[model samples]
Target chain A: MALNIKPLSDRVVIEPAAAETKTASGIYIPETAKEKPQKGTVVAVGKGNKDHDMTVKVGDEVLYGKYAGTELKLEGKDYLIMREDDILAIV
Target chain B: MALNIKPLSDRVVIEPAAAETKTASGIYIPETAKEKPQKGTVVAVGKGNKDHDMTVKVGDEVLYGKYAGTELKLEGKDYLIMREDDILAIV
Candidate 1:
């Protein structure tokens, strides 16, 4: 079952991919060495905000910056993604 | 000397802190294991977007989420942080 989320205005809630801890060389990298992933799965989406009409919808996978989206911990799991403006590109 | 940047509208340019590669135990982590840092230094501040009134200024150190901000590789260095709204808290 997926999360039931209704974004307020143009905000979008994305379920970030769990960062990978291994390299192409099969090296088991530690938590202190991985670069943030720019990809995520859309978990919940909000209605378009008043300004800057919303362009994304729920269940839409998107690509963002490594350092993108506000970090939020829900149900012991971390999730983020706010505002369509914050989203750089949709995959 | 710092890079000259002028954020467009409500966008704020933040110089993200380099992700730490070592843990308290002195374990060396690889590029595949570190959690993104939410802290960053304000490199350049935008004039605030039209819809959202500008709030932050230049040289303001701010804190964002791990997955926050669009990624940009400038001069071989990766940096991110955008919009005052994107910023969760300013340090």
Candidate 2:
């Protein structure tokens, strides 16, 4: 089923990467010990305005600023909504 | 003399307002003790890209984000170069 959310002009909805639950050294970390992820998969894109163009399509994995975007929730899943300019790169 | 700076697409050149030199209580503040001003006069505006249109013209007073834009120097005068989106409003 498609995501029911539709972002506004120049905005996109991203499904953030799951937070890390363990350390590189294989130490287990509690859910409360994790940092918010900076990477995500774009699920929805807005038709950009005259000065900007929508570059990323659905399913593209992107990297964004640490403090970019607003938090959103739908069907018990977390998402982020931000302008395309907030995305740093497509990874 | 006309300012010789020309900002690129969607960018603008602004002359920041002079920093406050006196406190509300009439106390003189040193130049080294003033915060950067958030208000400015638009000196140059870019021809926006296909996705955006230029909304501000030269000579418009504007309010911008506290930390928006890059600093520039021309003819010994200070200016800021930023995108139109950085401007919060025109006053």
Q: Which regions of candidate 1 deviate over 4 angstroms?
A: A20-33, B1-91
Candidate 1 reaches a DockQ of 0.04
TM-score of the A chain in model 1: 0.70
DockQ of each candidate relative to the true complex: 0.04, 0.04
Task: Rate residue A64 of model 2 by lDDT.
Answer: 84
Q: Give the runs in model 2 whose Cα sits over 4 Å from its true position.
A: A1-91, B21-34
> Model 1: per-residue lDDT, tens digit, B1-91?
4643334346666777566634334534244425666667777665444477776666666667667666654444566746678887655
Interface RMSD of each: 10.6, 17.3
Winning model by TM-score: 2
Task: Assess the local accuracy of residue A33 in candidate 1 as a C-alpha lDDT between 0 and 100.
Answer: 27
Candidates' C-alpha lDDT:
0.60, 0.72
Q: Which candidate is the best by lDDT?
A: 2
CAPRI-style class, candidate 1: incorrect
Q: What tens digits encode model 2's per-residue C-alpha lDDT throughout A1-91?
A: 5565545457788988777633334534235535877777898886766667899999988778878976644455677778899998877
